[model samples]
Target: MPSLRIMPKVMTLTDAAAARVSALIAQKPGVKALKIGVKKGGCAGMEYTMTWAEEIGKFDEIIEEKGAVVLIDPAAMMYLLGTEMDYKTDKLSSQFVFNNPNQKSACGCGESVNLEPATPPGFAPAEA
Candidate 1:
């Protein structure tokens, strides 16, 4: 029998991110997960969007780790592949950070980023 190939996850979370996610969802009763996506309104051409999800979407890519459940919007998958979600805290502030391999650049204010779609391993672009 031929072996089936396993696919890589679109995203993963760090321990800090998972703990923070677990804490955030604990505040709201019946919250299902955290949803993440990208939007096209920032100066750098894209912005990450996050929302508390009460329900999962049909095509969402789900990543659960250390009791934290995150739903990645299907539309954002290509841009999010090989990305790692992290939570960082300093004296000034705390925030969730995305370490994405597909990111090309970021805006001055750190509110937006320019991203390119990730090309999966062994994938070849169709000749145009």
Candidate 2:
């Protein structure tokens, strides 16, 4: 029999991020997780999109840490690989932040980013 290979997780969450997400889940009843993706239109060419996921999608990659659950859109998986999710708070505001290795650049205001697709180790593209 062929050996089974387990796919690696796309991203990870920090303690503060997990706690914040857990709190958000508690406030909204019946929501499964926070869905994350990338979109076009930002000055940097790409922007992150997040929403409450009521149910899991067939291709969604799920990450659960410290009681916080997050869903990664399949289309954005490559762009988000090796990213770390964090929550930050200051006197003026609080927000979730993404530290992504594949990011090339971000807009001046930090509203968007430019990213390159990441290929997993040992992965090879199919012949055209």
Candidate 3:
């Protein structure tokens, strides 16, 4: 069997977040993994998408950390670079949070995010 390896990138998850994800998976039967990605069509131009995965597709980018599997859509990798996943709990509510460094801004409701395009390899912007 081929070893599963994650590419060295800026994306990461907090220990607390990882533990919460593990607990979620354990509580839900038949959930093989978790999928995280970005999608178009949101107030801030981009939105995060997450779903429970029963099976992993061939093109899915599997990132395993702290005993949890995070499946990333191949195409969404670029836009999700430098992202961090965190779990939050408060008096009124608790939820998974995303700290994305590429983000330029977010809407008032916090339901959407806008990100800067990924820089190409070895490419630099010209000075104005």
Candidate 4:
């Protein structure tokens, strides 16, 4: 039988991240998920953007896990493949951090990152 789907593994989150997301969603009105994308800015050329997703877009990739929902922007999919999100809360700071395989470098403050497209298995370098 021919397969009809190619499910792309978007990303995952740590327990702390999931817990924080679930709590934040409870405070918002009619928000269904957290939408994640990348925008050009900061010292490293790109920064991650987060917004409340009231509704999923047609091309958005949805990932539901750990009691929370995350929507990946279509354009950011290629750069976010095989990534994991973690939340850290210390006496001085609290933030969500991305452990991305496609990231090439990050700024000193960690607010921005330089990203590269994730290459698929068996991909030829010559094609790039």
Candidate 5:
């Protein structure tokens, strides 16, 4: 017998993002899911990172929706809360974009962002 447990979701994806991710998995050999996180660097001090995840790590938060699977780095859970990942293309270029409410500011080049951890809905922050 198996037990069912409801887990909290740490992130979400746009329809375009989900479809794009699904296609990437199909094209890559031996790929499992897409791994995403934030790293320190870039002009804004933090850069969002995405890569091909061949296996799930021990503490990665797994989100599966719209025929796609994403492995979110545990360390990035706070910073990425309430974020919607999307895919965009234009005549100039194409890329994946993060629409994040917790993002405090971004650099001029749009390559990095300084993010503040997201606050839960209906919760007010305490004042000093």
Candidate 6:
């Protein structure tokens, strides 16, 4: 059975971001979704990770918004709660940006983020 945890608190997405994700997914016929997570490696201890999902695994947390599917791993949910996914475009750069509430700080280059521990009323961190 699929895990039935409460729905995640997703951040707001700009119209451009929604459109960009839709277009990108359309370009890859074999990709059915996008996976979002964090990995330990960046200067600030954590880095955002995203990939195309060919299929939704049994343990994945599926969050759908604006016709896009965001697949998140259960282990990464604590660091990503209340995070917003946005698209930004400027004369020199363009990319998908993550605005995460649990972030304590980020590296100077903005490539790494340090996540604060989750403190929801009834939630606790899993033992390591």
Best by TM-score: 1
Assess the local accuracy of residue 12 in candidate 3 as a C-alpha lDDT between 0 and 100. Answer: 76
How high is the CA lDDT of each candidate model?
0.95, 0.93, 0.82, 0.91, 0.90, 0.82
Residue-wise lDDT of candidate 3 within 9-123, one digit each (tens)?
6457899888988888999899988899888867889888999999998998787889777888877887777788999999998988988777899999888899775664565
Each candidate's root-mean-square deviation in Å? 1.5, 2.0, 4.4, 1.7, 3.5, 3.4
Clashing pairs in 6: none
Error of 1 at 120 (Å): 0.4
| Counted clashes in each candidate structure | 0, 0, 0, 0, 0, 0
Instruction: Provide the lDDT at 44 for model 3.
Output: 88
TM-score per candidate, in order? 0.94, 0.93, 0.84, 0.92, 0.86, 0.85
lDDT of 5 by residue, 1-128 (tens): 89986555677898999999999999999999999999998888899999999999999989998999999999999889888899999999989999988798999999999987766766576465
User: For model 5, what is the C-alpha lDDT against the true structure?
Assistant: 0.90
How would the candidate models be sorted by lDDT, starting from the highest? 1, 2, 4, 5, 3, 6
Candidate order, TM-score descending: 1, 2, 4, 5, 6, 3
Stronger candidate by TM-score (1 vs 4)? 1
Model 6: how far residue 73 lies from native, Å: 2.0
TM-score of model 6 (CA atoms): 0.85
| lDDT winner | 1
What's the C-alpha lDDT at position 50 in model 6? 89
Task: Give the lowest summed-lDDT range of ten residues in model 5.
Answer: 119-128
- Give a tens-digit lDDT track for model 1, residues 1-128: 99999989899999999999999999999899999999897899999999999999999999999899999999999999999999999999999999999999999999999998888889985465
